[model samples]
Target: MTLVDFATSSLSVLPAIIALGLAIITRRVLISLGLGIIFGALLLTDFSLLESGKYIFNTVKGVVIEDGGINTWNMSIVAFLVLLGMMTALLTLSGGTRAFANWALEHIKDKRGASYLAAFLGVFIFIDDYFNSLAVGSISRPVTDRFGVSRSKLAYILDSTAAPMCILMPVSSWGAYIMTIIGGILLSHGIADYSALGAYVRLIPMNFYALFTLLMVFAVIWFKLDIGLMKEHEINAEARLNESHKEDEDHVDLHDEFGVEESEHGKVSDLIFPITTLILATLFFMLYTGNQALSSSELPFSVLGAFENTDVGASLCYGALVGLMFSLITVFKQKLAPKLIGKALWIGARSMFGAIIILFFAWSIGSVIGDMKTGAYLSSLVQGNIGLHWLPVILFILSGLMAFSTGTSWGTFGIMLPIAGDMAAASDISLMLPVLSAVLAGSVFGDHCSPISDTTILSSTGARCKHIDHVATQLPYALSMAAVSSVGFIVLGFTASVLMSLAASFAVFSMVIAIMKMLSKR
Candidate 1:
């Protein structure tokens, strides 16, 4: 009803578009985000340069501190990133990385296995997308690197598996959050046919983008279908690996930026133990926090209930702290000098500085987007105008656009889910799940394509890939999956049959992949 109340009617989209274009063209993430933040601030401040400066400062302040208190969620995530970086350094210093790589080389025996390992790790770590991206990247990077798999490819694998897998599993933070939203939506619509968890599970078959994107990950690897820019990256990765082998023995590891030589006393357990501790500790805290939360509320202490109420940001921070301790213990066992350990810690924290800066700017712009009502304005454009049968498809596209513009999947969910539920309930009760599922599918798709997204940034950081390179290479795959899923949503809206829609989507996905593989051979 009050679309674009904060700024210009259509100018709200300009900042995001400018940011996205600059990111792709200039290949400088921070600059792009900075410019976007400035434009958004100007728009929010009615183009007054001085006022825009104030707006920017206040917005950034809000991100760091809310209601005169620390933004614990945001700050905790930042801390986790720093801790994870430190843990990674310790892994390297203790020679755990090298030993793990050597072990992978001997056991995997080929690049395909390495690729599968990356994909497996990505899917296996589904508790939170942030954790999934960073942990999988750390665990799989050494193996993937030894096999000459491109860092961009590893990032792609991480980005694809992290959010999609988490969104589908009820035990995951994503799933729990989505279910809570769905519960409110269902109650508001007065629908009694299914519970929130039940609705989510039923919608799984209808979430074409998430399902298709996931299968596409394995399909791309199995078919060797590296389309578009990805092929060139794979070629360059092999060349780089070959060139490294021919270099003299004096070649130092590029990641050893601290000038502290890694110890030769590292073993496979050095890598495994700390990482395992991180995972287990994170999971434990999630339940622990969730259960504690239930004690303060009326909710019972079921696993799903705990997950639904868990403090993800705090849990990740706690987990990282514990994991770092394990890494420290491992490093100490090797008798590495104290100076070297401190240097490793410094390198670890410093490596995350760029990511942290980008994240802050990204958050700042997101706040500006919210203040500008960009998402609300975008959703308003299609409301009450589309036919009922086309609602699902349109919502999927709309949700994708909203998420792409705002650079957040959860934000898109928050905005679109209620609108979708209201629309479906008013038109046809049968379409509720379809439309709601479309929004979920589209959000994940959009988040994948967005360069400013936290998941995208973290994926690149984890893989040690250039952020722009990862974005450029992953774009084609995301768009390809999105294209096929769009067609499926269209069919779904008309037929209202989950089985038929899934059958059609997968059928088309298979054909598209087959044709691409055939073309590659030629």
Candidate 2:
């Protein structure tokens, strides 16, 4: 395609690509995305500075005003993230996280067990990728450190399972978003009763990346296989632990930046109560919203209306209130007054500002891409040439590369979902199986290796290791899984059986792991 042809087909895509490159090189995600938005606007508006400015304003307004302004589905993510931050803050302030970490350390003492626990928790929190990333990183970092697991490995586990697992789960926000896109594609192709939601549930078992990555996580935990930057972090942590032992300091602190020092008065009940409440509340809300049962009764203010009106702000407000109340009633009793609780709530909200800002920019870039039809144009171009048989693998790799470069799986999914869905329909592919798998796999792959990815930064932050250190160590492991997954896709494309494909993929992964272990020993 000529430059003009390419630009017209997907003008927003150029800016995103440029922004990703800038972010990777400079490690400044927000700045890169800002530039990307600008570039996308410029491309769509034909470099007319005045027109680009208008496009930018309209893009922002369009995103903000959709679905009752801030209450729209696009902004639901922002709300979810803000609530996650507040919840995390409350947990931190209550010493619940510290208590859990200490308990985890005591229970899963070995490196292998620690790794397994981290991966296990990741699977457990498959409701949302953002929550999974932040929660797992915050809660499991300390336990992993105690076992000499590298920070990068922790990040890898968190990032790998974050999007992959959630994308597979039908109840998650990721599922809702992808299904909507898939449904639209199905409708366009004259298919009726084709539920994108149903398709995702069926394809989960067959999703090569999700299956392989989960297996890889378990393998890492079980084998205690350390390579790349992870190896370096483990060696360093081991040396530090050894030296501390030799010195025999009376008050030696093993806690790193990512860990919380256990409070003497903290109890397991403190951790269990808030977490259980959070999970129950989230599930209740999701079911209530998804099923529309709350709308049937005409109360003064219907429950469904309240939920529909609820934004991230409302959710966080609710979570903060609940957390504060729980903290006072259970942890502090009457000693916790309104002022103290208010302060804690404010602290919790403020703590998530960084993440909120990142989410905003990520959303902005994605909005630009969607508005300018970059993804659709690209999808059309690709559809004309590639057969359905090979499209899945190509899209998987493409999604992975895009996510890796951008360091945002949500952004990657946002860009690829429509395109992949359209292609699946055009090529007569099983709309849900290959396309969903490709999006899920690609997103994890990108999050796995991207230096600027928030999860990567958090992993490094949690591990108390250098960020680059974590990325270098974890890249090899992620690549290995991706390779195995690619082969699995190739085999599945021809054979088209979930069980058979997964079985073959697992075998290949096992063999690869064995070879890597043998080579590492030498």
Best by TM-score: 1
Each candidate: what lDDT? 0.87, 0.63
Q: Clashes in model 2: which pairs?
A: 79-312, 228-473, 229-473, 230-473, 400-442, 404-446
lDDT of 1 by residue, 376-449 (tens): 78988777668888988899999999899899999999989999988888878889899999999999999999
Where does candidate 2 stray beyond 4 Å? 1-12, 48-68, 71-86, 148-150, 176-198, 237-263, 293-321, 334-347, 399-440, 443-475, 497-500, 518-522
RMSD of 1: 2.6
lDDT of 2 by residue, 329-379 (tens): 543642444554555556555655555566556667766655665545544
Instruction: Report the number of the highest-lDDT candidate.
Output: 1
Residue 339 lDDT (model 1)? 87
